[model samples]
Target: MPRKLLILIADGMGDYPAQELDGRTPLQAARTPNMDAAAAQGTVGTCRTIPSGMPAGSDIANMAIMGYAPKRYHTGRGPIEAAAQGLDCAPSDLIYRLNLCTVSELSPSGLMLDHSGGHIQNEEALNLLQVLRTELDTDQVQIIPGFQYRHLLKHTDGVGTLEAGLDLVPPHDILNTPLAPALEVYARSPLLDSMIHRAHSILTSAWNQTQANAIWPWGQGPPLALPSFAHTFGLRGAVISAVDLIKGLGRAAGMDVLDVPGATGLVDTNYQGKVQAALNFLEHGDFVFVHLEGPDECGHAGDLDCKIQAIERFDEHIVGPVMLDLARMEGAVCMACDHLTPVGVRTHTTEPVPFCFLDSRQIQSGAHEGFSEAAAAAGDVHLEAGHLLLPYLLDRMQEADG
Candidate 1:
């Protein structure tokens, strides 16, 4: 009998104690009977997905969870996403993750009102990007449209000139903060500064109906290359995600990327579609990574109710159903979050995230009450290096099978 592996990742689902939840994290407060059962009948612990000194972003944490050490393989968030889009780029070309954002003003003292431009609709966002592309597209610079407020910028001539020691901050990190420091950082790159300012001018003048008033670019790097996942792990793997970053990492690792319709990276995402996609992939793949972005987006918005709802939906619509099916077969399931995106901070943090591993063949009598930060910490296992998690789970599954 062949044992399969299923990794369910609720992105940025970990969090600190919140007053709204009466000092309980969203995971603790949410109704997660499926996750609870996994913890109680399996092994629960904490894993530090984000390496020390690394920015607590999904790009780094997810790569670690997928069995690749970020310090060894990570190039940048932009290049990973570029790979997801199947964009060809030279080693010298500079790629950046661009965002259509909303600012209170364009001056130094202006505030970053919305990092996602109020979650601008796709049609409107594409129109804005098209206009910018028409005006700003040059031999050296190009603007590429992505989903919603997320986009991309490529600087074909920025290898030696604009790639060294450049510091561009992620807009989500500076939510509600003054834009002076970020603007100052952008000013370091004359080309980026001019382009950003020109983008603001054009967007405000052309599309005044939407909150997307400016373009912010960060996370620049060269083309990314990674060893094949199948070769590294000896498992045919597939990734199901709504966002490009995860898809990009899967693509870079030579894993099949599965797309589900209506899979918005929001609270209203297609839960059933993702579950179906993961189940279908598992029929032929040895390993399947199912990633949900709703929790992270709600955390970024500082919406406690929405975050809790997202967690519940993940458990009920995805985890519960998938776990039921896997339990009927000889397989193993691991449920975890990439990092902590506390509603209080409204951004990602480098903290150990809770996880539970359940082998259908050998369910253990664990003392864990449910799957939460506190419960997982109370359990016995703890992995300081998150990149080892996949290998650890596989080893445990193999031992159980033997």
Candidate 2:
């Protein structure tokens, strides 16, 4: 049998949450006996998903983690997300991650209240997407529903190669990487107005109440075709994430999603199933990616306790057990976060996150305490960018091959 690889991608899992609890992050504080054991056996180090002097998104960050350089292997967002949803793109249609945001008056202009809609449920987002799809009569494009904050607008233009040309604002800027003024330029363009108009018309429908129903869609672009974790490391890979962006990245790179029921994308997550599914899949395949979204969610919520618990879930339930199973299968397991979603800012930080690896063959002990961010400052490695992890991960796989 081929050597198995288990990649546990905890969305927004970093070192800070541990500070509230006597300097132990959720990963550090939680009882991750299995994970600590794995760390003891393997070489735990850090890598960068978003390299130095580059603007990054979870899409690109994950792409780098899977070993694809953004400059050479970048595609649109639609195809990337489609893959995570299990919808493979045809290379002709474009893919974009949709947001069910409130189209409030720009009068207030304050960052705190502009994003008033805030994490609408899947049922509600789907309802709005359906109405918008049926109402947009003019464009040759078609809109479809995705997750809570995501949807798809596929234009029938055949490999249009739309750029993930997202501007540095709100979600990117307010929530994460803020470095451009694309939205202003795009807003002035007639095309942007039409896109917004179509969505506005649907939200102001008979069913929706204008106040909250005025859902605004952003991050317009096409399906991307980037190389992925499987291609880079020669492993059969799949990504499990609540972030449509990461799910989309997995899709663009030819990967599958591991479904978990009751995944609310809040601090309270479905942990038991996620852990078991990961082990079950690794037993059969070479790679299995588990993306837990709660930590990021909690960070965005600015709930320190919730955030700590989210990380604790990973250490106690997810990564910890994954390491144990890998030990049995003689496999390698790696843990890392795409970005720093510090509760201080309650948004993604440019700060580089640490990474830890576990493999029985490399380190016979199989567990350690100071490998993640909380303890990384005290540990041996401090890596920057989520991308750097790729080369290290690829290197590890190549060594296994040798």
Candidate 3:
């Protein structure tokens, strides 16, 4: 029988111990009976998905998760998001991930009050984007909107000299920090920075403005291309994610890039729809990558309660249902996070995250009580390279037969 593969990724699900929770991480505090069952029956261990020295961004870790070495195939987040937006730019063109940020004031010296602008809704984001395009976009620059506050800033006729090593800070990384320094650093790109300032001025004057008051641009880079997942693994695959970064990665890897309705990439995202999409895709495809962003978002907001609730919801709505269906399959299932978004720093951390692996016919034992960071740390399996774990997962059935 041909073996199937299901990889479920709860983005930024891992975390460090918190004092408020009596030194327990959100995953540890959450009641995840379904994941605990898998841990009890299968193998649980920690996998260092974020390569050493990497920024611990979703773009890097997810590429590694999809079996591409970050050192070789990884590019900046901008290009990946461009791919997700279906934008084809020349090699010399520069792309940056744009966020509709809320600031204390419209000036460059304003503080970054909220990176997500209160998680601005799509309709309002589109309205702001359209206004920016009309007021600020020029022959040299354009703004393309994604879900909520996430968007893209493309330098159509860039001078091709924008180095990837510019010191622009991710807005989310600088919450409550003064934006002047970052703005000054990014302003080195004369044309791009001018457009940014212009957009901010226009945004501040808008009559129907949301909390989103400025455009923050970072994650700049040139174009990127990657080998197809099917060509590399010899199996048809699909990726289901609400975020453009993951969708672009999947598309670049030649995967189906399945879309589910109501996938807002938020705590309120349609968990059931995503699981159903994965299950429906598995009927015809040999591999499926299902990614959830709720936990990550809650982590970024530093809302511990919401993060715990998100994890529990993920287990009940997604994990429990999928595991029940996959039990009858003649394949393997792997559940893991791409990286850790620690609540303390409200940013991604480079620490190794836990992973749970279960083979339908060849279950293991001795896993800890559940699938949390501590449990996985106590287990036996450890994958040094996140990308290499994919083959180890896919070949489990073959290993069982042998």
Candidate 4:
């Protein structure tokens, strides 16, 4: 029988040493008995998910973790989410990830108060998006609503007026910073700049809520295409994630994208539902990729206590239950983070993230005490190419059979 594969991704769980934690990272400081046990029983190592010179965003990192080389397959964050929404686009059309964010003002000197608009709920965000769609939906531009504060802007660009070199920065990277630099970049495309200003006016004057007053568009690209997961790995695969970017990648790769109710990409997400969905998918699927976004969200907020709680909850709610279920099966399991979203920096870094792989049929004792950056670095295994991680786990399963 072919061995099964389970890959659990705790998004942005890795971190740099925090002064608040007495020089220990959030992972090291968190209470993660399940992760610690896995590291102690399996092989722990580090993998660099983001390619050199690429932006350290979740889109690139998760793509690398899903066994695709981001340098070759990545287009932009927007196109991936577009795939999640099942949007059709012409080759020349542009798609951007539009965020309903909180800006102190509309001027260049304004500050980005909250990238997620105070973690706006789905209903409120949808209402705001609908208003924008009604007013701003032109022949060339369309407003697409997504979960929470995440949304999309599809530009047909039929006239080819937008420059190919137009670049915009992600809102999350500029938290609590002056938005002038990003606004300057936005000015590169007059259409986009004007739409953003108009969106601000519409959102603030129309809605009583001051949380999400502006629309920030960035991460533009054409539609993305990927090789089928079954064709590449010879296994039926599924992906469970609340984030559209991950779901979009799964859709583009022809993998099953499982959606669990109440699985918000936040600390209050439904953790038990995700585990149940993963287990259900594994009943017939040969591979299942489960991703949790709580830790990453906390990291982006720079909330140390919440980040630690998110990591602990991940271990208790997601990792512990799934590991117990897979223990009786003939398969291998891997737990890892895509990239380091250090609370100190409050942004993603292109650092090698720690990972642990275990073969249920032939488990081996590992030298590490737990799963953390320092401990994984001290171990013997390291993958300079993150895309090779899936293959490495499969190879280990094959070796166990031999």
Candidate 5:
């Protein structure tokens, strides 16, 4: 049997802000004993959230993290999300992941939701999606379920000409500059508006039915695909995430989603469950990807204290457990993030993210600190993230077998 290789991915995990508000960087404040311990026992390097000169989103950044070049691996967004929903797609189908979001009709908003869908619970999101499904009578339209705060819809009959892209303006004022200008132009699509209206109707009906007020879905339309880890490594992979886009990304890459409960795309997530699920895949010589969405969420939310708590919880609950599990396994362990989401500066940043690897073998640690950004910058392993880790893993596995 091939060795069991475990990988832990902290999505949007690279940003450890320097002296932002509380004087201590987020990572420095975070109680990441497991991660810090792993670094002490292994290799530490400086890696980017994605490669230099690319737009950072889970869609593309994940591809790079998982060993695929975005240019070659991107298939479009819809098909990717479909995979996590246990839906299949052909290469030609223009699939997009739909975020059932709540957008404010107020000043200077980019039509994006704070939560994937206003932090709506699955029961609520699912119910509203069901209503939207019923309302959409178009022959080409298809509605698919995304775990929580997300849904998958597609124009099956190939509406390539009229397809409104999912990269619409967000409802976030913080992310205003990029999305607003684009949403301003694209929101005019009658097809997009039709979906939004139906979603609105379902939300209204839902509010009436449940007697609970919630933010309605705002962003509609499909996204194009990016390359997945599966296509690149020639190894089957599974990525479990609370975020629809991450699952959508796994789907786009031709992977399956492990059903996890209470998987809100928040920091207070079930990290242990994810660790176990990834270890479960050891029976097959494949990769297991587990994504945590919180640190970034807190970062974007500008709640530094919350971000610290999440990271500490991750270290205590998730990272520590994963390290222990991988220690028992035969293959080496790899860890990294999708991008740097800084506290109080929630958007993706270009700064170098820290990566550490652990296994039974000896690793070359070149003067990098065992934790945080400043510490990581001091170490010897500073370079492009995607280019190094994947190939290095392939080489390591090959060498072990040899």
Candidate 6:
């Protein structure tokens, strides 16, 4: 008879005012009747998920949102993604995010053209990763394939606690920037440096056919361990996300990581499938954390219309349906973004993003009319740190056992 909870995360849903939209953020402009209804009947406010001066990557931000202090638990995005791919790593293994990127050159330093390499398909990406493995992988290294442009490269015996401190930069953060400065970090390790150079040679030859000419390695870290969600929060939890990082978070938290067919983690992802997955998990789980990556993808692409469309689609296909299903259950619901991925910057911001939570049995009045950056800013109930918000959210639930 424990109270149930639903946590919905629209990745990078927060944004700044758009000049073309008359100063309205995408969420402010989207037709989110369902989210609006939740905001109007719930407690809404802003919360800073990413700690100050952090990389602002989804890995760090989401760790905070999931109630694990990023400062303590976060090793790097690479290790989390490795966990999601079910890749076993020793404590001394150096894990990196191997993105199939487009570069202008294959020299020691080149211009990073596209982090996603036109959002290459999974089949093609896998093929390219295999080629990399053949050309680069040795007894000391392993190349693992993941969805779309995301992949992994692991260097065994290269990431002891001391070696894990490599200051690598995420390729997405340096779009249109030179790669030399970033590549210099690997120079410390002769093997890794040579691998990058050789990988470039192999990629340059295949550029004409693949559009992906290079593998950008970043987010290096050693193996990691996290406290289980059940142990920390006293709830059996499940997580639904198309992205490996979120799935990794779920696995680290000892939550059920569900895989929904047709989930692409893009603007055209399987929204309905995710909603259904959430429903299925919530049927027996004490908590369900649902995450969608479409809005964040569009924001990173700087496509205003697509971002708005993604937000609208999330409302119609995911939020609306889940809310309807939750209506018949005795549970509480909460919705929020992990961090702000402003379309202008085309990257994650450390600003405080907004959130809204409501009790199913007693809907509070005087709540904001809708969920948006502006609306949440005006409302009360701000949490200074994002990790604290989850516990606060659970405290609002109406107890069925009572």
Ranking according to lDDT, highest score first:
1, 4, 3, 6, 5, 2
Q: Model 1: runs farther than 4 Å from truth?
A: none
Deviation in Å, model 2, residue 366 alpha carbon: 10
Which candidate's lDDT is highest? 1
- Which digits, one per residue and each the tens of the lDDT, describe model 4 over residues 271-331? 9999888888888889999999999999999999999999999999988997897666677
lDDT of 1 at 328: 58
**Each prediction's TM-score versus the true structure:** 0.98, 0.80, 0.96, 0.97, 0.81, 0.95
Task: Give the Cα error of residue 97 in candidate 4, in Å.
Answer: 0.6
- Residue 312, model 6: lDDT of 92
Q: Model 2 RMSD to the real structure?
A: 4.2
The Cα error of candidate 6 at residue 396, in Å, is 1.1
Q: Model 5, range 1-402, lDDT digits (tens) per residue? A: 244566677766666556754566777767787788777777777766465665666666776666667666555545556655656654444555566555443223533336455466778767766666777746766777666655666666443545534344333323423235544444666665566655555565525454222222233333445455566666777878787667766666667667677666688777777777777876674777778877777766667778778778767877777777664666577666667777655677766677777765544453344577666677667767665567776676676565
Off by over 4 Å in 3: 106-109, 157-159
| Per-residue error (Å), model 1, residue 237 | 0.5
Q: lDDT of all predictions, in order shown?
A: 0.90, 0.61, 0.85, 0.88, 0.62, 0.83
Among these predictions, the greatest TM-score belongs to 1
> Candidate 6, which segments miss by more than 4 Å at Cα?
106-110, 161-163, 206-208, 398-402
Which of the two, 2 or 6, has more lDDT? 6
- 1-402, model 2: which lDDT tens digit per residue? 236776777777664654566765555655555555555566565566676655545665667776677655655455566665666455556555555655433222322232335667677766666667776734556666777766666655534333334441434335332212434544554554477555666665677743434433444444555655575667777767556766667666677776778666666677778777777877677777777777877777666777767877777777766665665888777887877776766667666666677654566552455555644444455555455565566566667656
Q: How well does candidate 2 match the true structure in TM-score terms?
A: 0.80
Q: Write the per-residue lDDT of candidate 1 for residues 1-402, one digit (tens) a residue.
A: 345899999998999998877899999999999999999899999999999989998999999999999999987888899999999899898889999999999779999988899999999899888889998889998987888988889989576775445888899999998999999988888888899999999988944689999999999888889999999999999999989999999999999999899999887889999988888877778999999999999999999999999999999998999888987557889999999999999999998999999889878775578899998888788999889999999889878878
Give the C-alpha lDDT of model 5: 0.62
